[model samples]
Target: MRPLDPRLLRYAAGARWFFAAGAVLAALQTVLTIAFAWSLSQAIVGVVEGRSLAELRTEILVFAGTTIARLVVTWASGSVSIRGAARVKSELRSRLYRAIGRLGPAWSAGRSSAGLTVLGTRGLDALDDYFGKYLPQLILTVIATPVIVAVMFWQDVLSGVFVVVTLPLIPVFMVLIGWATQSVQRQQWDTLSELSGNYLDVLGGLSTLKSFGRAERQLTRIRVVTERYRVATMKVLRTTFLSGFALELGASLSVALVAVGVGMRLVAGDIGFGPALFVLLLAPEAFLPLRNVGTNFHAAAEGVTASEDVFAILDEAADAADATATAVHPGGGPSSAATAPAGLEFHDVGVSYDGTTVLSGVSARFAPGRVGVLTGPSGSGKSSLISTLLGTVAHDGVLTLDGSPLPSGPGERPWLAWSGQRPGLISGTVADNVSLGEASVDPDRLTRALALAQLDGWDADRECGVAGSLLSGGQAQRVAVARAFYRALRPETRVLVLDEPSSALDHETERRLAASITELAAGGLVVIVASHRRRLRDIADVELALTPAVAKR
Candidate 1:
């Protein structure tokens, strides 16, 4: 389903009542405002006809009372509208993040970080007007504008028709300009989103670029992106300026026509001077709201454009889908946490993406007390098989643990420990990265896991530096693996899946990793590692090489 617009109604439904009340007040203000103008005409006409001073005082009192009341109601309505808008923007951002969460990694990989960011910052921002200004103004246009026209018509139907006719011109010109700029605005939004992503990437890779002595080259690339963003922004601005000019000119010309008509009618003695003057005065106010609507809507365009991505994210399939719950350990066995007693088993499990096969019909078992090692070439579907075992990837074929089919989709799992080639670390002390959500690791367990992962030297008290800037490749990689081991270390953890365990490690580090694997396997842990490092073979019992055919295409 298409996602809901980031709107106020979703957050503070109670505020919707306030918005309604505000619209009503705004409508009343419109009538009083016009009535105050009429009263002025009355007071002026009465005074000119040699009315008494006391009558003039009463006339002035009426104008003051009505105008002041109108201002109060208008202010009250504006307050409600603004509050509603602010609340909706905040709620919508939270909703967007929530939606992104639902879709999981498979779904998230398809979207750009820059696009998601724009949706959060700009997309939610659009709701400000969607709730506060555009909506209220639109409501006023629907309820108040007509009432204004009716009052004008009551005094002089011809003037009423003249005022009503001007209303269509403002929107007609606006829509015409809107059509012309729609494509440009879309292009501008795309450019802005891409620019945000590029900038974020550059900043993220700044250190890496500097290390490679390519920071200057990246800076030049960033300058190019900045110039592109500027050009796109200027294009949108030019079009917006043209649109405003058209709307302004159209509204002004139409109001001027009303004035000329009222003047001509009064000169022809078709109506009294007082009524004609009233019609002339009220004509401009009727069209002002519509013109304002166009301008305010223009301001909202950026928000609206950015909100599309937010909406898309909200509509995405969640990260924790039920269809992706089952996991298989790299030993080609069902998740060990399975309690059914059927034990973990993988029967001809296979997986493919975009017609390119990653894992093919393979059968294996990881019943407790048996440790299985998955050994193969770099692209031999070893890691892909591990992903299926970890329930991180959707796959084809049957996986059963303890005799029952494994859960296939969504939600956090309690039993698995799978680490990828490059593990991520959040900003915090070393202790925080190691536990993730796992309870505080005991000092002994922490030390042992760190030693096994070859990161025993890291001080728990030091800051990890945004993604652990202080850690070397081996350290970071080991830290990631240690997190899995420490996070609820199931000594009986049925399957331990490792992808490229020795990718960047030196011989000594690789030796330590192999020793850790051997110890874990000897303890009846079914361990699987994707490795080209033959040193791993010392600890591995079964070497399974996934041929291109074995892993599908």
Candidate 2:
């Protein structure tokens, strides 16, 4: 049940075919195993009874052929299982990536990059054993065990009784071991996630640690986490080994009991020589798949644990998306004409995070052909207000567009554009970063945007390393501003929002950027800027200041 997490089977539609094929191959292998065992008995009994070598040769060949076929089918089934696992892993990773994107930066801000990384990469890769060995063996146990046992009964009823009685014990022991190892496996997986997150975090802050003269102390922390992980892993391995040994011992004893029964019956002349020998050979075959399943389960437990965590995230994301979808206005909500920007009205609007109210009972209005600046101290919710308007965060009370309730979801408004405090850039040329998937890059418009943001000296073709590392702080800010302008140039863009636009700029550059905001407002777009700088506030047609909410006595 733990191995068969429903979310995996439910979400990975493309990979289901591989599982189906593996089950079919398992059935085929089961048939071949029984057939080979029958032919092997026939060849041995015929030779012992002094039959012609020519007659026995046919049984020998059939046995050999069945053996070869089983080998080939097993190899093919293994290949199919591995390919299916890869496909499932790929599909799950894609779904996770898309879900993370839909959840937006706010949700991601609360999670560790290293933890998510390990979940998507190493955590998923751990499923290889589950799919490739454990699942196929499990299918064989389900399909092949009863059939082989029935065949044993047909050959000799006493030996079949022994197998039937002993088969239940294997699963009984497996369940007991599973109970003990389940918690340990879960603990090991959690430890692994912690280790991965801590190591990546330490590495990211290595420079800060060195500057603060605390770099060497971090080694002790890392070592402690690593040792904890090692201990957890060793505990899982010990339980797995002990469980495997116990199952093997039980299977061996069961086979021996059947062998002794069959041999005693032959000595008493209660069964034919051929039947006795056949039952002896077939007794162990009945338990082989079941024993292998027990052995393989340990290898797959880690993946099952990781899969539970992945499904939990996917489910939460789906619920959030469903909630947002219901909140969306069907008629595309409020829209502005090409010549005028939409008016925005906040009526006692409020926002909260983790039970702490950031903005409460605030009201404001900004209209077309006007610039609105939000002035506030840190943690006074200027950025949160911008996020609310952009539909990134849910808010209580009402926000209206042209005097109607606004749509309540991120990306619900194509007309809105925003530039955040930290500019996010990929590893690409300057033009690539600014154009950002635009089908046609207009040289004139790009040049104008860059000039307005005071980035005219930067080469359009120059490479901007990851997160714009090649550029200085102020230059990166300008690049983000230029991208915002380029987006605002689109015919559908009616509202422009900038958060801390001049935080990295000097007086001259800040003045130039402020001029650009006013120019955007003059062109009939409602422009909103969240900044503390006087240069930006001085240029705004309307200024809204926010204060921290007071606690009631």
State which candidate has the highest lDDT: 2
lDDT of 2 by residue, 1-553 (tens): 3647767777788557876897799889989998898899888899888999787888988898998999999899888888988998898888888777777667888998888999999888988988887888888998999999999999888888999999999999889998888989988888888898988888889999999999999889989999999999999999999999999999999999998888888999999988888788888889999999899999998877777778888897889889876653222223333433458877777777767787788878899889999998998899888888776777676677676677665555777778999989889988998988788889888998898788887789988899999999988888988999988877888889999999999999898889888898889888999999999989888999898873432
| Candidate 2 residue pairs in backbone clash | none
- Local lDDT at 140 for model 2: 90
TM-score of 2: 0.92
- Candidate 1 lDDT over 1-553, as tens digits, reads 1112434354446556756676677778787878788888888888879898787887788899998897787778778877877766666677767666555455567778777777688767766665566666766776767777887899898878877766787877777777766667777788877788888888888889999998888777778878988888888788878888888888889889888888888888998988887777777778777777777666666666666655555545433343345433343444445444534567677777657777777877665444456776666777777766665566777777566666554445565677888778888877788877755558887777777777778687667767767777777777788876664256546666787767778998888778877776666656676777778866666667676654335
Indicate the residue-level lDDT of 21 in model 2.
90
Error of 1 at 439 (Å): 8.1
Model 1 has an lDDT value of 0.71
lDDT of each: 0.71, 0.85
